[model samples]
Target: MARALLPLALVGAFLLVAPPFLDLGWQNALINILIASLFALAFNLLAGQAGLLSFGHAAYFGVGAFAALHLMARIEDGLGFPTPLLPLAGAAAGLLIGLVAGFFATMRSGVYFALVTLAIAELFHSLAPHWQGVFGGEAGLSSMRMPWGGLIFGSLIEVYYLTLAWVALSILLLWGLTRTPFGRLALALRDNEQRVRFLGYNAHVTKVIIFAISAMFSGVAGALQAISNETANYVLFASGVSAQVVLYTFVGGATIFFGPAVGAVIFTLFAYLVSDLTRSWLLYQGLIFVLVMLYAPNGLGGLIHQHLRHRGQLDWPRLARPYAQATLGSLLVASAAIFLIETLAVVFSRDYAVARRDAGGGFPTYEVFGLDWTPLSPVPWLLPLALFTAGLWLVLQARHPIGALWQRVRAGSEPGVNPS
Candidate 1:
């Protein structure tokens, strides 16, 4: 009973705490986070569990959104349907399309499977603009949310709750599915497809079924997005959407169930809040992805798990000095790189040139975090360069000590090892 109630308690706590802190804009961002989480979760189901890398999952997502919009339009025109049930239309569409597409796509595996999915998605993307009657051209389809069950869906708060409920239900269902026999078989197939085939299981059919189910959930997310935005567009079918889900799942830790959820929340928040602050947000995101791939391939969740698993064995007092030094050195190197990049960017940017002209200056001083320096100044460039060199030297000097400490920690954390 305690174990069963833990999840409920956590969710209840989240529901209580999440809304009050967020303004309308942030509440909307939260909705995006929920939707993105579901999409990433669906992708993880296939990629993480079934070992099927799909590069065209966005095709199903777009189809669902378009289907939801069409349903809304139809209902508005006189078809009897409740507004709340519209997501089912999207789910059905996604499932049907997934069946057809998965049949052919699943016939191939590995890179061939990925390429087939990509081609299918691209085909839909190309057709969406030309099939203006159905796709509503570039503008896509828009519909107003009608009053249903004494709730007006006009306010942000209402929409947030509605999305939250659907997301919660979807997550529960997906989690439940993971505990079923089919889920175990999917895992087995992922680990050894030939063994599953030898065991008299139709691996191809299993893959197709899982693919369809994954697509169905992706559709649900897309449907919710359509209802929230009241529009669906060709951009939904773009390869970038699929790529974003892959990034979210992989970066969050595909090995764990909630890893993609963590990734989705972080990615959505960063995109929402950080993108407005800088035009180089994509560069930062790419850098993060590169770092994660290089240093923590299992992702943020894996890193967290590793820390937790080894926490008891970690000699914090002994390790802290080196860790702090290494961190400081790394930060200095990163800051230097950022400073150089920003300075060069400002020097060449039209916006900066205009700002400089407006300031009536020969070389306009740039201000960042209360520090003012001219982009053309040698001092600005030389200071960071010197810092970078020093930091790099310090890092090199500390590498052996850090490496030895890390190995010791790993050895101590091993199951059979004696910490002493």
Candidate 2:
């Protein structure tokens, strides 16, 4: 715990102090990071801890957003609701819907449970557009954040702080839950539900509670989003929203407690930085998920934990070299992929077609990676192919040394081992 303090304090300081210096676009992105991190963490509760993978978590998230919108509208109508506490509306709606949904969904485990959750979210997505009164129809809902206390609640920075406070508190609570007896039981459920049932614990009830808790927190995350944006559409209930959270959790390594948030922050920031530069940002994100799944199946958090666990036994410079090789290989592969994707996107674009037609039906030159390359040219095909081959070979080569290094550390056989 003592060792954890310094890092946590520095992180907290960065989060608190850095936003004021950022431009509006970055401030908005930071707010998004907070919300996405919270959403991933909440999903991790059910998926990671309880072994219940909810594909329709967007259901609760949408509910929370709409609920918060309704509250904001009320506050707009001169009600005395505190702006800071508006997320409770989301929390309440999420818990209520979660209990109702969990009752039926938890009856079945595995794919059936996932399908049921998917069905529930689809149900919401279907109904939200037509049910204008509650969901505000196709227009969704919109409201203004009212002033509370001396705070104006008018600026992005103000909203960022509000979101930060709520997210920090919610995460702290979720972490605390893992220390409770119920937390251990959640692990049991994840490992073997049959044994938990054999112990006479009400597995169904336990699942419902866990699901509700996950949804409630998910709702809070959604509320923060609504608060920041001041509007939401039925798109919140879309399957894409649900899928994104799943990606964040597994890609971040759901086995580690804070891994999903780690994934969330990285992906959110990635999207922020890269989305402006390329239309294939989603493709890049998917490629990243695939690569992580293939090589680092334990996820980033697992890798971090592995290093920390063996920190005292390892040689930093020696270990760092293999890690660097792996990083270099991954970057090369990613660059090759980006090059291929961008080239394809340009080649298949309508403007490219128009240009080709104007040029008498010939393949045209396209700009990519700050250089122009002709379609049907051998260079474009050869470049990524060579990159892919070299990157794969480099990665494969690094794995042997990396594995051996870790093996020696595990065996306490490495020379110059530091007892500290």
Minimal lDDT window, size 10, model 2:
411-420
Each candidate's clash count: 0, 1
By lDDT, the best candidate is 2
Encode model 1's per-residue lDDT on 1-420: one tens digit a residue: 685467659966887578867788988898999999999998899999999999999999999999999998887788878888888988899999999999999999999999999999999999998898889888888988777789878888888888888888888999999999999999999999999999999999999999999999999999999999999889999999988998899899998888898889888999998888767778878787888899789999777767766777777787787878878888888888777767676677897789878988677887654688876678888988998998887778777787787799877768899756
Model 2 lDDT vs. the true structure?
Answer: 0.92
The TM-scores, one per candidate, come to 0.90, 0.96
RMSD vs true structure, all candidates = 2.9, 2.5
Question: Per-model C-alpha lDDT, please?
Answer: 0.87, 0.92
The sequence of per-residue lDDT tens digits that candidate 2 reaches over residues 38-85 is: 999999999999989989999999999999999999999999989999
